[model samples]
Target: MPAYEFPDRLNGNAVNAGDPQHRKNLADVLALLHVGGPQNRAELTRRSGLNRSTIARLVGEMVNLDLVRESEPRETGVVGRPSPVVQANDGIVAVCVNPDVDAIAIGLVGLGGKIISRVRHKTRRVPSVDKMISIVSKVVQSSLAKLDDECRIVAMGIAVPGIVRVDQGVVEFAPHLGWRDEPVAQLMEERLGYATFVANDANLGTIAERLYGTAAGKTDVIYLNGSRSGIGGGVIVNDRPLSGVHGFGAELGHTSVARAGLACYCGRRGCLETEVSLSRLLDIMGEASIDPDDLGPFVVASKDRRLRKEVDRQLDVLSVAISNFISIFNPEIVVLAGFLGELLEVNPERLLERVTSNSFHQLSADVELVRAGLRSQHLLIGAAELAFSPLLNDPISFAQLKA
Candidate 1:
């Protein structure tokens, strides 16, 4: 796919707060380029509602700071002269890492949401924090070594499938991975010599969806991602991920779906994750081991009557949880990702029927149920967005920091 310009700006406003207008202007311009693609000075002025002089000054400053570039004017085939196109500088790249229960994926993502390179290490045994750090650092170093002289690694973003303390770059808890309170970002920065940010994988997934996926241009969205280990949830209210003070607000999997169902790893009974997790489904199908990549085929090939019944039962339970979420959030879009996406792809009509029938008429009628747009790469792209966020908000300060 052609790389489109869409950077996650959900965290943009937090940076450069001392001079709000300057930060806002820079963020606005960057967001415009990210969403609308390259634009000329005239187009930017018209779209941003800023005067031509201000647009010119901002564009010039961005170009000088190496945050943006001005391409030669392209013919419009109109009566007027061609306008010089302005776009985000592709030389700036971010190192993105996503550490999950089963694997670690590292990649180099450029400013305009392009994945330049990626490597994945899958392990049968869960990896420790130290093991993950070593693997990720090596991959990042190798990726960086391959970059051309003009390319610069600005920052690194880590997406963990757990409760994250965003400010501290700490993984508060990841039940599936058996991790807790790990200072991941700090360790990465110390080891890799780059500024690092860490966040919950599903939270970042929602940001990816809003900025580049099916939920792009939509205001309210709820995203649910399922994997072999468990489920993670994210909520976007007015385009911002609803990260609570501790950045652990949207733990949707822990939400109770069954009052007397199976016990959850988090000590909860009948949690959404307990009922719909890929492991549970695989177990129901009599599988001894779980392969995250082979889930869809396993389900499709299963002809056991007991397995089919269990699948339908799980769907029924999942529908109840989804219905409750719809009543509570009333999101414009509900995105089912990963294994959930596969489930929806195979049985969208059945899943939709269950959810809509269980939900309130007015609320469920307008909500669009869709599969995730980005597959395995959602969290990685979201991590890159986190790394690119500060520069997008204030290119001048970022340039100074680099110097």
Candidate 2:
């Protein structure tokens, strides 16, 4: 027998194979119930472009697997026609982890998009590639052990903070992690037994929003996650993440907005990140004699008459960078994550207004700029979404492979 690994063990068989019509039919039904909420058989068939018989067969299989539930029948406008709504079952869970910035966060997520359990652990001082994976693996194992064995781990997602070539499972560059061209997914697969996926941290955040957060199904979305180093942007257009031919399409932080300004982590000067990122903003606040470590006190000071004036002055520079972004992407929504989102919560209308006033009138008119809903969990949840993505379109494939 092949060397077996605990927790990552697979049953060594191909995923389920049903008729193409059945697979497509089931996907449509799940998509409708997932995106549109519980719907009756007739509505599912109508929305999915499938025949009534196909819907019945797929729904029957789903009900047997406990992936969906049937609700009480309700009367429709058509006389004597009572249809029972089919609802998604939240028991099917996915495990996700974010390994970055010297910490790992693990979350158990359900199909209905709820986080069942979440925990965070420190990485101590070690920073090797193997050590990072081990940290995440341990956290996952511990979390899974807590759940009943019947609670199926449908998939796993990982969000790493650097350039991630998902197709290759190689993290090409992570200056912060001190890693270069590491096959993280393969390592995890060998170690854990379950399939895995890796993605750029910010890109995963975009998926989190598209999957369960506010940006669901929007054709055009630009997501920007902030940090002291810079802000990373994820672009989705026409229902796909726009990773360029080289899989690095949306590196917005490197875009030069000023010819003469602070140098960025990527060795560039006056990039938008140098001016608008949370770290840069904190640096500016420090110049005003505010203590960076005491962010709570500093925020309170910011609300004071004299302190708020200084903060607003600094925001003016960042607003210019956002305005430039508006002229280019013209996205329907731009989500701000990381520390910037917290700052925005403290001063919502101000940042919103600043971007609008600075951006082009026409572009700003249609664009809605907002902060991330996941907050500190953004990277962790994004990572989980990445790990689980490969299993989404093929439920039968997973069903065929027994544990």
lDDT of 2 by residue, 165-185 (tens): 777677898776777899987
Clashes of 2: 9
Per-model C-alpha RMSD: 4.0, 6.1
Which regions in candidate 2 have their CA more than 4 angstroms from the true location? 1-18, 36-38, 71-85, 124-127, 280-314
* Model 1 score (lDDT): 0.80
Q: State the TM-score for model 2.
A: 0.82
What's the alpha carbon RMSD for model 2?
A: 6.1
Clashing pairs in 2: 8-192, 8-193, 15-397, 16-397, 156-387, 157-383, 157-387, 158-383, 159-383
lDDT of each: 0.80, 0.67
Put down candidate 1 lDDT per residue, 1-403, tens digits, no spaces.
1112223332443434457787678778876886567889999999899998999888887888888899999888878877799998877999998776667888888888778887778766787888888898778778767889999998999888888777777888888888888988888888888888888888888888787889888888999988755888999776567777655888898899889989988887999988887776766776645545466667778787776676677777878888999999999999988778777766677889999999998999989999888777787888887888777666666777786
**Model 1 segments more than 4 A misplaced:** 1-20, 282-298, 301-310
Clashing pairs in 1: none
Best-fitting candidate, scored by TM-score? 1
